[model samples]
Target: MSGCYIHIPFCAQKCSYCDFHFSTNHSYQNEMVEALCTELKIRSESWKDEEFQTIYFGGGTPSVLTSGQLQKLIGQVKSGYRVSNQVEITLECNPDDCSTENLTTWKKLGVNRLSIGIQSFNDEQLKWMNRSHSAADGLNAVRNAKQTGFDELSLDLMYGLPNMTAEEWKSQLLQVIALNPEHISAYCLTVEQRTALSKWVKEGKLTVSSNEQQSEQFELLVSTLKEAGYEQYEISNFARNEHYSKHNTAYWQGVKYLGIGPSAHGYNGKERYWNQANNKAYMTALKQGNLPETIEILSSFDRFNETLMIGLRTKWGVSKLQLFEDISPDKEWFKIVKDYEDQQLLIETPESIVLTEAGRLLADGIAAELFIIN
Candidate 1:
């Protein structure tokens, strides 16, 4: 029921659309890797009694780690925590790093899943996004992973770019389907502040897609993936039945997990904590044997809002009984639920409150509107 996440904050180059925590500077790469191992040891002491069902290597790019580095990290996990035989170990990789040699080494090291970031299948799009790999690199990466006997492969696809025709979007989806990955996660491109994409837009060097185009592309993704026999497990994730990602699913299920390394967040049932985002600060804190994370004690209202927000994003939906009990059966909640139901945004059954497909597109707004003030 619990999981572990290790953040690897290194990338060959920063993507124009990325605002994630990472650096292309190799000056501290060796130090960072050592510090990460030290952080893992410090984080795992409390979890020695519990077993993890999933261990995710997420980040700027986990594939950047060498075989030895990867092995040593997994070794620490095995020695420090009670790991289950059925644990899903997923490594998030960039297409340029998914070589045959690396895939084979990862397989030997017990990595059960590979989530490759393919973004898009058009070279122009890749260049526009400042991605390091070409479309051919993505195709080859998938082939290499499969050739190395990896059955649990997931591909990340991006859509809703400026000047990207609907036909181009369809072609991208079709190309991914032809690759026969067990799972596909389609994400809509957004221009986040502080990113090169945002700067370019401000400077009139880049244009963002219209909201209508984004919505249309999202609809296209759902329909195309459904027709291709992939279940829309989440709003953005599609998978062949039983191939859903366990690591991410645990988050939606509100399972407790421990996160190690800089910029990582951890949740243990009632409380949540997040580590320092700066690498130098994180290393200094860990060197002093301190767990460098900000802690938050969840109030009842906080818990209710979170459950309502995250639970509604999944296919399992939020249980009506649980919701009623989690939050008081107050006039505010009752009014919110009734209003949403009247709008046909939610289906209220005896057991749960589920969002219809139409409601899902506007999920964040709906969840925000329903949030209760303490």
Candidate 2:
């Protein structure tokens, strides 16, 4: 099934480690809403026959938008595209934005899922990350979401902070478990270039976590979540009762999705396109009835490599027969797979080949090694 992603590129404050396309300007909210709805209308013509199974509002902060703004955008999608009755609508919210009133409003608007960005419940860490929410606010948000009756709830956590000890990481995980969220996404803290965190590291103002520490924390995360009856469906995501992020899962499985708004990416199986990152340019183009984007037609090699990279990261590995058919007659590739299997890094079943627990640590490396360089 296909999905639709709406990018909200406005945030109250930029996170220290975030490098995603976002602006702290709230003045352009109304204009952005108009442009987004217009873009959705323009793109919906191609998908008139298609029905979306999931609708995700991802962003700098989707919660930053008012209920009216959100409704207008959702209304556009309802009128312009065919959405399934069981569509999973998700909105990414920060803890501070999860007020009872806001939660009730979103629930009424049919937002079935809420992915709260509670990076850390520790006050110091929250401050370090430049998040607006306090530790109390994070806990209160979860309680409020649960009380508001969201169909599914997910919490985002980060580990491998330079100053976070093993015990502290454990505390964070336990706190999340206590909240009883349906899904949990734990990510390693990586300092991307051009981000405040990266600059701090380069200036010797902040220390970054070592690879060894990150690895240990990752192992801890998997074991702790597994013990809590959560399935590690993806490398960084854990879910209970099969309540996985259908939108993200579909993306990994090569399902086509329409991306709305600036800096958004869309894939249509054969070709991928991304909108211009600049908000002004995006709005101007939409006003002029043009799509401000670049498209790339995927070659066979590109498709194969992407399949391997994305497929191997999930609990569902690449289909053995399909992989063989796609990259058949390549003895070298077969040899590489054999070597990995022999090393116990990959487990081969009759239907598919999945990574072992140890292999997961080197997932990126393994995918890279198996890439079909053209």
Query: In candidate 2, which residue ranges exceed 4 Å CA deviation?
Result: 321-326
Highest lDDT against the true fold, candidate:
2
lDDT of 2 by residue, 1-374 (tens): 69999999999998999999999998989999999999998898888878999999999899999999999999999889999999999999999999999999999998999999999989999998999999999999999998998859999999999788888999999999999999999999999999999989999988988998899899999999999999998999999999999999998877889999999999987899999999999999999999988999998788888888888999998776655655653788778888999999998788887998888999999999988877
Query: Can you tell me which runs of candidate 1 are displaced by over 4 Å?
Result: 321-326
* Candidate 1 C-alpha lDDT tens digits along 1-374: 69999999899999999988988886887788888889888877677767899999999999998898899888988888888999999999999998889999999999999999999999998997889999999999999999899999999998888788789999999999999999999899989999989998999987788999899999999999989999887888899977999999988877889998889999987899999999999989888988889999987788778888888988878866656565666787778888988999888888887888888998999888888888
Error of 2 at 272 (Å): 0.0
Model 2 worst lDDT run, 10 consecutive residues: 320-329
Q: Please name the candidate that would achieve the greatest TM-score relative to the true structure.
A: 2
Per-candidate TM-score against the hidden true structure: 0.97, 0.98
